[model samples]
Target: MNERVTPEPQRRRRRPTKQGIVLSQQLIIDTALRLVGQQGAGALTVRRLGISLGADPSAVYRYFRSTDDLLLAIADELIGRAQQGWQPTGDWRADLRAIGLRIHANYQAHPQAAMLAAHRTTGRTHEIAAVEAILGILRTAGFPGPEAVRIYHAFVDQSLGFAALDAAALALPAAARTADLQVWQASYARLDAATHPHITATAHLLATDMRRSGYPYALDLLLDAAEARLRAAG
Candidate 1:
């Protein structure tokens, strides 16, 4: 007996409405990002997106079968934005550092988008290209294949993991963010040396430095360890 095969779903083609506005995939994704940026992640619903785009909510379904599909596209767009105009210098370590920082900065700029895309995999063009680019950097660095793959995995994972975390913090309300900063200044800074000796010892530095993002320092540490590994392999 022959088995019947299920037909693949066809993609919907978009056309101009009576209102004379044409909706493209890029417009939908860009509008979604702007909506999140302006009103926070909670504001991203099909209705709100349609309102922002000045179209009917059902129009979105033409391009994206579901909200999840739209979000994945938005995630890929963030990756695309990060890679724009980024050139890799020949120095492997330097190139890795630059790419990592670029990715982090783009995600930081769109914290709400970053949070939405954090755990999800787009498996789209931009993301695939980024993976290839990073792996190529490792291969060019003279690390053996297995070692290069391991390092690449760690580098990308650490970068995205931190980006997600920092994005969450960035997405906090204005008052909440202020309160977090004030905690380090007013609360941690005021701790008694005798009570919390370690924190109190670094209290001055904490009040001054803790307010700044530490991802750069963390990246340096990872690179430093990788360099040490390269030296040991020599």
Candidate 2:
């Protein structure tokens, strides 16, 4: 006769959760980036992000010292993606142009993040690294110390300024966008009718390609100048 043997219940091991307090910071930043992409930076707030993430509002504070800290993180993320796999090409102008275009395109991809990062410099690690890289490249090109600094400042200003302007334009209401277009169109139409040689004579050609050669053309022109300067010095 076998005695009834009742096996004791085995204790279940707790499966690891992908999301928890450990992920809270990354989650908040990711959610913030999404909201920023859709709505624009103005709509991004700690409280709002917390609500969206179902986390405590102050939980962000644990990772970021302040809202500015969070914004810098967002900037690093936005700008950092373009910098993935980026390496020095030794040709200063070419490298610089590549960097400028990459940075600009990255901002354009995320207009809200662009708008936020454009104005706020939290001195985040990536931001500093970008600056240092530019300076190093300029030095490699044999730019004088002062000249390198000047050109670096101008280069950064151009990239960030244009990105901010573009992001702001994209954020405008449809009516505002239309109005902006129409105003420029009307100005060109009026210019076309002017009798002055400088004003009306070239207006047809000038007004036709308002955005045709756009920012890339301008960037190319700038690169050409920088290249010329480098060649002259060499």
Candidate 3:
């Protein structure tokens, strides 16, 4: 009689979300990025994230302590995306140039996220990796430790500063952005030459130039200075 006893059935694990999508830190970050990109940073509340994710808000909290934590993660994720597939070519100036441009371009690609998170200090993986790579380039280029740090500080600040500035413009409502872009042409270009001779003289140039991002030219200037410093150090 004992040999005929039945065995118990095994229970299946519960799925993390109603949509049956598996939860992960990367998936959370990706969803958050998309939300911010589409609806602006103000729309990135935990409840909204949960709705977008088809999960309980508690699930998101399990991965991040708070919204700020998630924002830092998003910022770090942008840094990671910027550096993805990048490798040093051993030409320090060229490498730094490439890294700076890559970071700027990536941030511009997600203007809302850039405007929201560009100024944050994540102390996360991508941020740490970026610092390491930049410092390595400067140090290998013959910069002393302190000089290398100083240069890295300036380099990162310049890149992020321009990113935030450009992103602010990009994040504006389409009509507003168009209005701002036309300021140089519509306002400055019409100024009377008598009282605004200098502005009038260069208004045409400003109309075109101001519409373009100054990041590339500024980045080259920084590289040129770094190259000069390296030469002078020798």
Model 3, residue 170: C-alpha shift (Å)? 0.3
Error of 1 at 43 (Å): 2.6
Better of 2 and 3 by lDDT: 3
What is the full ranking by lDDT, best candidate first? 3, 1, 2
Report residue 117 deviation for candidate 1 (angstroms).
0.9
Question: Each candidate: what lDDT?
Answer: 0.84, 0.72, 0.89
Candidate 2 has a TM-score of 0.80
Put down candidate 3 lDDT per residue, 118-195, tens digits, no spaces: 999999999999999999999988899999999999999999999999998899999999999888888999999999
Superposed by TM-score, candidate 2 places the C-alpha of residue 91 at a distance from the truth, in angstroms, of 2.1
Candidate 2, residues 1-234, lDDT tens digits: the string is: 122222333221133223433434456678888988877766578787766666655555556666776777888777677787898888888899999888888888887788778877757677888989999999888988998888888788888888778777776787997677665457855754445657566666666665332667767876777778877988
Estimate candidate 2's alpha-carbon lDDT, on a 0 to 1 scale.
0.72
How well does model 1 score by local distance difference test? 0.84
**Model 1 CA deviation exceeding 4 Å by range:** 1-20
Q: Candidate 3, residue 184: CA error in Å?
A: 1.0
lDDT of 2 at 214: 60
Worst window of 10 by summed lDDT in candidate 2: 4-13
User: On residues 1-234, what C-alpha lDDT tens digit does candidate 1 reach at each position?
Assistant: 012222235323356644556777898899899998888877778889878777877767767767778888999999889899999888889988998899899999999889989677899999999989988988888788998889988888888888998999889988998898889878987888889999988888888786777888889898998888888988
Error of 1 at 104 (Å): 1.0
